[model samples]
Target: MLGASRMGAAPSASEEGEGEPPLTPSTCTFTRLVAKMAADKIVPVALELGGKSPMVVMGDADLKRAVAGAIAGMRFTRQGQSCTAASRIIVHRSLIDEFLAEMKAAVNAMVMGDPLDEATDIGTIISKQQFEKVKAYIKRGEADGGVAHSLSQVPTDPKLGEGYYVQPVIFTDLPSDSPVITEEIFGPVTALIPFDDYEEAVEIANSSEYGLGATIWTKDLKTAMNAVHRLEAGFVQVNQNLVVLPGLSYGGFKKSGIGKEASLEAMLDHFTHKKTIIINMT
Candidate 1:
């Protein structure tokens, strides 16, 4: 029920799980698995899948606030493990130096230790397997010609060093095609991609296979609106990090997934079906 390997039988609402029944099987999971179930006609799947979300920092952006927004988007609150995490930061070339410096400082200052401690900003990675996976991504990033800056330092104390802990890292000087910039690493790691102007920024953000969520930081209303019109992501945040509340649809476009969540449409998706009753009274 928890682990992917353990979740053998897909969740079914029907009393008898022998055959495919009329059920709404909503999932936010692996794309390949979803396709298999969909082909078998298991149910009308409402999938909310993966993301390689982006954060756009325009030349006119409020640098201070954008730094905060980028950090929050990367999920420093939970070590950047969220599906909607802003793994790619596309900033105007003019603002790259300032944005990167502030972002590095913000990540470096985060407290890393036991989650039970309120002061701790980041806890250990989910598990040793996940820990290794994230580490491998970091290595892959370096191999791809991305300059790495790690905020995580090996703790000197034996007790603090026991668990699967990794320092928050940011990669720069990588091309847009790098896997570290394109794939979902699902860790406290983000890639900084520099662009020349607004058009280039949108181009980089839209280039990803994922279109789940995105954020744009700019003081220019015109530029923000232009991005909103062009960026392919389902959920777009202007001047803020991604945050969804009740009554708002939360889902993605493209390979990111299908359908909606946390809104009335999601509830209706499962509860309602089309029924046509024709009666003629003569």
Candidate 2:
């Protein structure tokens, strides 16, 4: 039997006790049943977990609009804290100066402090470990000859420091294989890679190990549509910001992740089996 687990209230005994509550008999039985069924499966099971996502902005894009959208895509939802954030941004070489200038201005304007504060635009990292990991990436960026620009000075509050907090960081002129460019920082860190032309932009975007999602910004409808067809990512956004629509299937190609989620069609594919039925009553 396939059992779908739902999030419920915490066990009362665990809340009252000093030590954690032991797994209940029912939960233990369910775990064993799942293991046994998996062990006896006739076919191999495959799980496509997660990865680092990249966002590419072409030379033809409007610098102001693209930079603003890129900032939102990178920093939205507290850096997504997920596998799908726009971790790397590839812009055309000609637009690099304008793009970076606008991006830096936009990022510098973000308010970072108390999450509960209505004016706060940025929030803390998930944990101390995560904060350290992100900081290490910042160091790596500097060491790799990538310029580091912080959105704001690190907060001075001791209480805030106790929690995981990192200022948004942007690394510019990053080499293709640099850690800042190649690996998933998984924090509020982004790298700006410059390409020469449209062909080069598409090449750089597709060069990554993860092909989760991509955004194309172009005034020419033909070029935008061509990019939509050529990109390796599962989810492609043209002349718009990255967002989830109820009607669109969301997933990635290669190492980004597996299967699809969100859309009703994707959900149906995940939850239902298809069979071909034939009738010979003629």
Candidate 3:
């Protein structure tokens, strides 16, 4: 059975099992449960888990486009809930200020309110529990010496209801060890880490234990390619937001997952097995 990793309170493995080996792709915690069951039954399983994706902004990047891409990559869809969201932004020290300013303005301009409304750009958190969790992360970030910049004032619209709506946040002046920089907030929040040069930038981008997705923004083709090769993410994007299209192999490295989906790899893993049949016809 196909299962999602990131969603909370998923169906139990017993409920989904039909006497066959199960295929599960869920959170790291949930994967543990699935792994136990598979081990007990001696069946094969697949798992996909959490991420703390990073977007690297090089000194030579086009500030205007990079800022827009960062905002779009982090906030435009699902309020940064996806595993592939570029929640961590590592930028060159020289371009950090300009990138942050432009990113702040672009994020502030987002429309947050009723999701049913056509004009809404940002939506509410999935639940109250999720809202609180995200808020706690924000507070933890501040305590860790990261300065939080509120991108939007809480909307006063009565029509928005009592849903778990949260303002987007950007943390700056943070060390690479900050919780905001290291953990996956899974909210409309992003952190900026300044690097002195290309080597430092690449090092910081790969510092995370989660190697799901990463993006590189730079005008120099050589620099972009170098980062694309060096970043530890399973999927690396260059000069654009992280997006998964049809027919592409989708999965993460390290703790991200074990198998890919929606591509040839998925077909091979879940649909077919190779066998060799030989006969002494000669």
Q: What is the model-wide C-alpha lDDT for candidate 3?
A: 0.77
Candidate RMSDs in order: 8.7, 9.0, 7.3
**RMSD, model 3, all Cα superposed?**
7.3
Please write out the lDDT profile of model 1 over residues 138-209, one tens digit for every residue: 776787789998985545668777877888998999877776776776678898899997788888899988
How far in Å is the alpha carbon of 20 misplaced in model 3? 43
TM-score of model 3 (CA atoms) = 0.88
In the range 1-282, model 3's lDDT, one tens digit per residue, is 222334554333234453321222335566677889989997767666678888998888889988888887885558777777788888888988888888889888888877888988888888765676577667767877889998765668776668788888898877777767766667888888888988888888888878878999988998887888899987889989856799988778877777777798888886687789989978
* Best candidate according to TM-score: 3
Clashes of 3: 2
Per-candidate TM-score against the hidden true structure: 0.86, 0.80, 0.88
lDDT of each: 0.77, 0.68, 0.77
Candidate 2: TM-score?
Answer: 0.80
Q: Give the candidate order by descending TM-score.
A: 3, 1, 2
